[model samples]
Target: MANPTACLLIIGNEVLSGRTRDANLQFLATRLGELGIPLREVRVIPDVEATIVATVNEVRAKYDHVFTTGGIGPTHDDITSECVAKAFGVPWVVHEETRALMAEDYARRDPPVEMNAARMRMATLPLGAVPIRCAMTSAPGFTMGNVHVMAGVPRIMQSMFEALAPSLTGGVPVVSRAVHAIGVFEGNIAEALEAIQKRHPDLDIGSYPFYRPTPGSTGFPGGGVALVSKGVSLAEVEEATAEITAMLAAMGATPIQGEPG
Candidate 1:
């Protein structure tokens, strides 16, 4: 059976404009990998309403789960909640519990303040969606169908995701292994690597090159291709990695158990 799949929809004008570098995709991908939900794709778009709606609907329909980050804050530019609501044809409404939580949190601050419209905006959500709680900021995210809207801030987004994680069911976690070799050229090993991949089609094998800065030396460090594998079965991943190691040994390159740190 196929494993549960997820897609990330990153929304923010700052991200598109290069003002704010995104940090959520890698975090979510790693967490989901541990949970066995493979993140199949990622799309980064601006805060455009129509584009967000279209993309949210597309990915939500195609994948088992859809995660959205950014554009859910209190500012005017934060429009992901509304776009996601539009995508699902749902009316956006104020989640009363979230509003109350925000109100209480604001009231408890050292400089007690009113829950103004701007702050209240954080409590709004698409009607019928369940709130994804955020302990740090009283402003919470929400879940609509397969779509999960989260905060743009890395810290708050992480908190909201933790709240929603227990509710999500995941498939068997993929077993991951890596076989590395130092100073082995990709061009020289391409043929052997292709044969090994063909032999173990079930494994998700990836070859990545690494670099290390040697100040005194002019050349890139003995960095080489890493043959990483992921599969439902540990034995299969290990077997494929072993074959790659054997291939490297035959080609006079020592295969290391892990990549260079």
Candidate 2:
């Protein structure tokens, strides 16, 4: 079966401006890949409601599944919940379960539970959305339609993703075997590699080259090339791998299978 296609929308000014590095994209991508789900695209946008809603609607319409991260906090920029609600034309209200979870977390904190209004804001969700729980954090994420909303924090986002994992459908996960070529540059095999890619369009073909002092036959200092091809179709991946290996051999480059260097 072909892997289910998915897209990710990362919402936050911090991530857009580099104030916060976007870790959630890679985390979710890895997790989804493990489940045989292919991530098609990823977009990072500000916390503005219009942008969030537009992106959510666009991605949700295109992919089998959509995920969002960030802007679900208690601060003013935290408008993801409301934006999602607006996108679906549903009422945004405080979900009881999330409120309970937040309340519990507040109770366990050092200062004790204050039940402040700002903290309680974390409980809001779009109507009919199913809550995706995070054991690492109090703010419960939620799923509505094809869109799954998760927290911005890495640990919290991971837990929420795990909670939602079982519900996703997937095919055989894409598996990859990389080959490294020392004492040669990518230019040496560029034409053959491009031919292989054209032959196996379904597979993801990538070539990475590292710079190092040219080593003699002793393998002291030498640059290398890394070739990686990944895909759900085992036959296609294997075929591409064989072609890549053959190309490397033609260039007299030793093919070291797996991770580069």
On lDDT, the candidate that comes out on top is: 1
Model 1 ranges with Cα > 4 A deviation: 216-221
TM-scores for all predictions:
0.96, 0.90
User: What is the Cα-based TM-score of model 1?
Assistant: 0.96
RMSD of each: 1.3, 3.0
Question: lDDT per residue, candidate 1, 1-261, as tens digits?
Answer: 788999998899888889989999999999998888889999999989999988988888899999999998778999999888899898888898888888888889989977888877878889999988767777888889998888988998999899999888898898888888888778888888888888888887888877766778766675677888888999988899889889999999988887566
Poorest 10 consecutive residues of model 2 by lDDT? 212-221
Error of 1 at 8 (Å): 0.2
Give the per-residue lDDT of model 2 (tens digit) for 97-142. Answer: 7788788888898989787887777788899999887677777889
Indicate which candidate wins on TM-score: 1
Q: After aligning candidate 1 to the native by TM-score, how far in Å is the CA of 122 from where it should be? A: 1.0
Candidate 2 CA-lDDT value: 0.85
lDDT of every predicted structure (CA atoms) = 0.87, 0.85
